[model samples]
Target: MSGVAPGASAKGTAARTANESAPVDDAEVVRDSRPARRGPGGPMGGMGMPTEKPLDMRGTLRRLLGDMREHRLELAVSVLLGVASVVLAVVGPKILGNATNIVFAAVISREIPAGITQEQAIEGLRAQGQDRLADMLTQVTFTPGEGLDTHALAVTLGWALLVYLGAWLFGWLQARLTAIVVQHTMFRMRARVEDKLTRVPLSYVDRQSRGDVLSRVTNDVDNLSMTLNQTLSQLVTSVLTVVGVLVMMFWISPLLAVIALVTVPLTVGVTSMIAKRSQPQFIRQWRTTGELNGHIEEIYTGHALVKVFGQTDTAQRVFDERNDELYNSSFRAQFISGTIQPAMAFIANLNYVVVAVVGGLRVASGQMSLGDVQAFIQYSRQFTQPITQIASMMNMLQSGAASAERVYGLLDAEEQEPDPEPAVRLDEVAGRVEFADVDFSYDPRNPLIEGLSLVAEPGQTVAIVGPTGAGKTTLVNLIMRFYEVQAGAITLDGVDTRAMTRADLRGSVGMVLQDAWLFEGTIEQNIVYPIATSPGAPVTPEQRERMLRAAQATHVDSFVRSLPEGYETVITGEGGSLSTGERQLVTIARAFVADPPILILDEATSSVDTRTEVLVQKAMNALRVGRTSFVIAHRLSTITGADVIVVMEHGSIVEQGSHEELLAAGGAYARLYASQFAAAAIED
Candidate 1:
């Protein structure tokens, strides 16, 4: 969620233009890489961002295999089934060839029933200048008074049917097991990526393109799932089919086997050449997809301001540009990878032709039986078939590898520092927060805060005020430990914050920022937030009571009761159903429900209207009566009654005291108050 409302930056720009005094609220922002035409895409860090490349495909694949180690047993079974299926499939053609041999031998022997020997018939054919027919007859076994052996042929055909049946059964089983293994592996991969998201530092997250990160998680992982499905299911089976067919071919006839092997080098060469060209395109296709997603996300989220600025046409044109890039890259990748299968098929057909002619000559010379020649021809077809199937898998494999590389890049990203071992725990937090000798900078080359020291005693309200980019919000961020200190320590109840797990530390605090968040859910559900969303967990009576009490205190109950659904009325995350002031009120109510020991409000009322701001001030006054509260406000009037008002300039505390005392001293705080009220006076 943005820390500022839509158009807040524009408001900031206007404020700057008018008074030359707009506070730089530099926190994290969703970025667009391209130069801005009018709105979001404008001049963000300058120029088009460079796309990512897959530097080490082999290492990435190895890491992917490591993730699948848990499912190795199922994968092993799948591979064995694939092998069995291919072996049975290869043997089926050979078995059917036997029936052909039996029928031929029986037909030749029909002449025996006429009281003519096989030699006499063949010699008469040769004498009649039918040398080819006589030569073919020599390869067939002729038995006197024997016709075609129908019984033997029936048995041979039955065995062939059984062989094919086994092939189908094994293939189906392999497919099922492969699916299981792939789903399980994807499950683990997603889990790892999810965990990594939580462990990465805020700085790391801020520097990344949000759309790119999301694409890796959603699109890339989905693509990986499909790739694994194609690869795991067919790769082993195709390879084994080729090997088994080759063995059977050599067993039948070495010459024919050698002729079939000629296509191997050509197949390998074509596949390799195509793969090299397509791999980079596939990588670019996915990267461009991420950039497009990022652009859409950025534009869509800021669409409200886009319309306010009349930037719809510009936004659509930019979207078209991104979409066109994706389309071009996708087309090139598909077109290149698509050539492999047809090329392999052509090479295989060439080998098939050569084998058919040689096998026919061998049968005529009496060197090979007609049945053997038939089986060898079938073997040549099977040989190229497996090779073709494997070639067909190349596109999916490369696409999947590109997806894997991106996902693994996310998984391998640097994580946040580990919490200190033997951590110190606060048995009871009295909410005494302190910063000592703190030094920090978002960019180390340019220091923002140095030697900052402050203490918030129990139940004291400290209001931090500063000029734009003067580190007002940065102060509270440090207190929350969102950014770690470079040279000092921050303590909560006398224990270093670094010693506590982030969850534990964050659980003690409730923060309401300037830009409020309301998710897609009922008003009551959003107030309860994460507690309401946890799986299978019911909201407690106490939580419900807190929700009701807070809604009343923040004056949210008034508007809610006016609606037909009351608390049950659903609102989108965009807060379309509620006004800006109402949205801010809902987030304030959420803070009230958290009931944390410590509260940090970063310009929480900046987005509210005058009437709503009064109601919020009343609610905040009541909420902070006995809590250690740190309020960072740009408005001077809001902090007039604070127990301590700290005035800062260029990251250093210039003046700090009660409001009246600062005005009496005529220091930095006094001038700030005068300038703010003076601006108000001029407007009046």
Candidate 2:
């Protein structure tokens, strides 16, 4: 029902009217917001793009590789292909050099020294110990008068064809191996993330921004996959290529090889410098991206508030500023990263010129053959190619390292202490709960509850009432073992809760939170979620009937019946399609379906209207039969019928007795009841 504000509409109208009156000013306003490019090959486009922050890259890669290690065969195959690719790429130039030399020698012998017979030339070449006789005799040239040697040319063509096939085959294998490693790694990482999210203390989530967590699960993992699948594989190939080329270069000419190797340290130095500087930027960029997503989510979720305040322009401006910051950060990261390619290429070309000039002199001075010079030049080129690639892939390495660090950061987080021993499942648990001298605090510096003590006998309905932030929610959290108490023990039927497995403890206690989150699925799915928690549970007709009765008791069945799909009706995420009251009823029905021995209803009907509250109360009463129930209620009237009402203040029990006794005490409970009832009476 929410829409844009009237003030925003008026402002927009005024702007339009002004623009109509003077279009020139409006046009200038638009132009200022757009990025400007100054000259040809300006820094704005390709040069100054911000480098990606390194945080996400390291974190993401570490997480991905950790998972990738799970599929050893795929990773092993990927590595093997990578090594083979490097070897083949290095071998290509050598083969080409040999072919070019054979052709050159044949031409020089027959034509350069005129009237040199083919037979005399062959004998002279062998006498000079330049015995390329076998290769030269078999070689064929593409001359204007003579047609191509269909046989010798075919041999050359066949070798060339094989090289091409090897390249393609290795390339294909590298791609497949990289894909499998990335896919399986991401799958495992996703599962681990989800599992950790569920098991961690709720307080941990409370301390973090939801957007940040969501970003880790989505953007961070995706970036990891990209870096791993694309960058990591190439990085491996580049390293092997560099090694292969270096070895070939040494074999060709050790002196020229040393000259080529001189550029190695400089290239590595520059690459390392850029990588070090760019990592932080990539981390910052991803952080900003997470912040931007959070802002967008906040705006959309609170669209009604935005309209109410008539602050659409203000919000939009804020969003634009954040978005621009991201763009600038990204630009800087990418610019630095992109520079690596051209920088390495420049150094490589410099090396190439040095190798060519020095080798040519050696050949002309009779110190080396033309064939040796040619081969040296080819090896030099090959050497630089991988160096350039490695320099380029350094950016990817940075990105992957960043992602790996982030993933490891999460993995390194200390989980809550696991239960000391395996749990023993009891066929039936008496619903008695006891809190003995319990002391707890969300933050150690600020204690919420100190020396709190309480007990609920089996089949008793105990209600807790207190002002906001008086440790009401903390009590529920402790009961569920979401947070361990700093001192004292919480027991169920005289057995310490901590002694039992968290899963077993939680499975025995059913909770209906104030805000219920339903996933994007059918109504039936939500009800059946409890039983499916086990590995082998089946959804039978009787289970469905029980769930339906539970819903009907809470009056949710009526709404389901009115819907187009009844029990099969699909709900949007977080139950957005359902009304708040309906969502509450659904949660109540879910708890009923769970049918645990101990029930905790934390503000179960606080947000519902009178009719819905009454319906929920009835359903709760039915469900509470013969079970220990802890009800934390804001509305005093709802808990008036409870067997005991315990008043709390600042984490301590102030009063406890039957509601009637507390009302007669004319203390905190009486004052709370009077204030609320007085407000309702005034409205009436």
Candidate 3:
């Protein structure tokens, strides 16, 4: 069990412990190991963060937009609303300028004295070739010392206020619609990524840290979603605002418009340069964050082992190194991206100054009115405002793109090859398993098993005994189809295993590995998981009875009944609450309840104490009565009663017979058996 427990090494166990403990929200651990945040250019570190490679920005953006195609209608509507909103906003200053012009014109008009007749004032206006003004004044009642047309001014101001109010209302609507669209898009993206994870091969999972994978699913997706929601709407609005303002500025005064437009290229150039430089830093920052997360996950999981091995100091040092790297990368990325806003602001301010000065000159020269000059300055500000917004949004977009690239990379990873079509399914398997002329290797360059062949007749106990790394578990892995044979076929009841779907193949066999895996659920739920979740007909009362009997057979019922909740006890943290031996018993019971025609027990009792092993062996013997069983054991005593004992050495069978026959032959099995007893004697 020491050798076979997944990642059972001192360091590996420690890491697994930390990882398992992570979901529990251990505040003390988090606070102590919390990543240092040194502002913009430091590590944006968190648990389960992922490191990513440099991405092709164009490709990522194209793919991200392609993903948004399903929501194109919503996106289009949002953009249209944003455009309308910005256009309305752009038209506001001009309307207000008209109101100002009205007031200015009214103030300059001559005052009508108390004695002056309305017809006389109208005749005076007509004498100055102001026929339109004279006609408009004919309806007005002249009052003493009334210098301005107050009613006309009030009406113009009211119209300007209504236009501004309309712009605000449209802008608000645009924001609400954009939120809905972005949220829906994010939902689809998250769902797709999650579905992708289910299809990805275990090989890929084996190569990645659980934390890193989780980071991609949670943190990366969140980053993409948040940035999309914030930046996408702003992106649309900013662009339309810039364009609309530019058009209005040109209409007002093309000379001033051209001057304002000059600052745009400079702003863009500065932004592009900073973005390009910051991009690599952002990439590195995210990567380091992942590394840091991976480290933290490992350290926290293995904290128990760290204490056992007195490695706390060593672990801390490793963490600090990763944290510092994350900090440096984060600092650089943030500092560079941060410069975009200020740099853009400076250029925008400079443009505003130039427009204000130039418009003042134009107004003085009689080339433009005071109202037109004021409106032009406002348009210039509006135009530069969008450019600055776009620059700021670009920074967020770049970060989002980096995150999207990582997520897409995960989505694009190779999936498990599709199951063969028209695959065979067995309703009832006789369990006569055979491995014929199998050749395999974890790495092609270094072969682990070559030309391996084995057979187990129905209801027979076939015991496989070998020293460590003699391809014991590897053989079972092949039978289970966790890996496919490289050169030959593994068959069940004379039919090729590959001819059947993996689900069908695995469903016919029950496996109890060295390390017991229990999820966060009740003991009863874990025990009956297989039957409950099976795609076949729902579990019957008979099956429930069988489950209870199996638990009793495995002695799991003994300790379970002692607990206050009995089988109803909720197991958490991968069954950390249970003792190692107790967990093993539960797994055995689970396998017994599964009750497949075939059974493969790989070091099932290797980790338990002597007393627990005795109970487990007894349970296994009872369970094996009518099933073809493959027992991979290191302890010679466990396999002594088997009908056939196969001794393997260096991936090949060296001896095969019953225990008595093998002992009489004095072969590899005899030597292995003798050595075990010798070690036992020495320990005693």
Candidate 4:
């Protein structure tokens, strides 16, 4: 059968997209390459990114087999066992034919004419000096029965039974060994892909949706495992059985073997034709599955938006289009692959009839015996059985290869450049940060930051204010080493940030983003997560005390205490139970517990209510007392007390000074401040 089942196609597609909706062009599937696109909300935020193309099949399989090299010994053993099993099975028909010949000889030899006397048979046996047979014949004469050698017949049947049992035992051993090889190989392969994910560039990851990456790791790997488990043993056995049965057929009657060989070319031609026709359908099936998944993900996740905008019917129409495409492609693929078995069976049956007639003529002409003809016919059936099975398995093998190619594509993706050897390590960071003639851009053709220069003294708060798309968050990303600057350098305490390891640089900087994230964990665990996951020595009681102190300082402890379980209460579903302001406070407390020398607050209070914003602002002001901080906010009121406010428009800084000084200058900062003031006044 066809590997492209409707359910499997849909599931694989959904796994690939991971619930993000975006359009994928057909060209992307062929080229299998594209620059990563940063969607709204950051690199992983958008749904429906383009699907990656599968790598060439030859390379994928070669790499896959290379991975199996470590288990080569086990695979070899499995192969040997499988070959032995098939050989035993192939010999069974010949053994049975031998018994048939023995029975026929006894029947023909024991037949006596009615006019013949029993004494005559005994006298003939005696003349031939067959005393034992002569004595048995005399007894049969008195009984007037046809004497057949029952003991010899039983002996032949017993041998045949033993051969079949041996085949079964060997087959079971082969299956056991094959399972071991497949499962172990898959385990290592999975671990390797997961490790590769960590080493790949964030830029590459940002460009793709979460679902695409997950599909490679989960669905593709699963397909490989399933295919290997099902196909490996069968492949070995089928090939061996075909060869063995062919050799046996030749032994019985070379003329009949020739007839069986004629079916080979026909079977192969039919299989190849069907496979070629089914391939494109399989590809389309997977592609449309991804489209359908993307559409479902987009609509389901944004269902509220769809209803609010009265676009539910439009969404339904789009879904129907994608679903219909998947249905059509799946139907065609299945229908084409489904033809292989019946077609092969027809050719096999015709070959069988031809062999039977020729063998019968040969037997009658005394060129072949009855038992040999019987064995040859049985061998013909056995020979075509594997051919039919292999034809049926062609579709599954193709699907498996396709899945492997996709997985290899991911594993072969560009990884992050290795960290510099013997990288500089910061011993004592004092929070003195500088940007020197920095140049950067998400897109090189459209520069976002050009020749930027700035310095923040130790323990000073620098506020960055700008309109949307002013590279505010981009600057913070560069500082945190999320993205590298195209030119110049950003230094912390006289050392270029690039010179230091990313882990060290980022560990020294803490951030509170506008959208606070809280994984499923207790409140205290979230606050002390940095220490918990740190690679250094285990956290001590003193560190635990400090975490609690940070939570209290940020005023998160007060509300946490009101909950039924206080600090131990579990936060589930990304902390949906918490108010927006409460979540922000918790994130702020997490940062405070980290005790980094530098801090970044990217509109940290943008999602809070006015009353909560005032309280959060007070807590933030206190947190900024003795640390270098970058505050990127649209609200002018939040940054009024900043030591210096840098006003940015487009990609360049237009002005920089204290809030009061900027207003007095009546430049970009003044216009921004006035605009916000007017809006706030209207709201009041």
Q: Best candidate, lDDT-wise?
A: 1
lDDT of 2 by residue, 1-684 (tens): 001111221222222222222234344443343333211111111122343323554445454556666678777887888777767766776666656655665555444244555555556666777665423432322232232234554566567668767977997889887877778777887888877766665444433445555666788778777877777677777777778878887887789889988998999898988887777767666666666776677687678799899989987987888789889878877888889989888998898888889877766554566666776777777777777877777776665565555555555555777776666565678988999999986445455678999999998999999876577766776887767888999999888888888777777887776666555677776766676543224567877888787787767788899988888887885676788888877877877877788988877787889988888888788878888999989898898888889998878899999988998999999998888867455453
lDDT of 1 by residue, 91-157 (tens): 9988878888888888777754557788888888899898887888887766656797788889999
Descending-TM-score candidate ranking: 1, 3, 4, 2
Model 4, stretches more than 4 Å misplaced? 1-55, 113-150, 533-547, 622-625, 679-684
> Poorest 10 consecutive residues of model 1 by lDDT?
38-47
Model 2: how far residue 564 lies from native, Å: 2.5
Write down the worst ten-residue block by lDDT for model 4. Answer: 1-10
- Winner on lDDT between 2 and 4 is 4
Which candidate leads the pack in TM-score? Answer: 1
Q: lDDT of each structure?
A: 0.78, 0.70, 0.75, 0.75
Each candidate: how many clashes? Answer: 6, 39, 16, 9
RMSD versus native structure for model 1: 5.0
TM-score of each: 0.90, 0.82, 0.84, 0.83
Q: Tell me model 2's lDDT, rounded to 2 decimals.
A: 0.70
- Predicted candidate 3 versus true structure: per-residue lDDT over 1-684, tens digit per residue: 111222222223223223322223442444344333211111223433344345688898888788778778877887777777887788888877876666555553445454665576667767988776564443234443455677777886787777778778877887888788778878887898888876665445545656666677888889988998888778888889888998899898999989988887798799889998899888777666566676677777668898999989988887888788879888988898999989988888898889889887766555776677778888887888888888888778888888888788788777876778999777678989888989976555446678888888999999998876677766776786656788988999988988988778777777777777776778877777667653223456776687789988989889998999987788887686898889888878878887788888878898899999999998898778899999988898998999899987767888899999999999898898889777455453
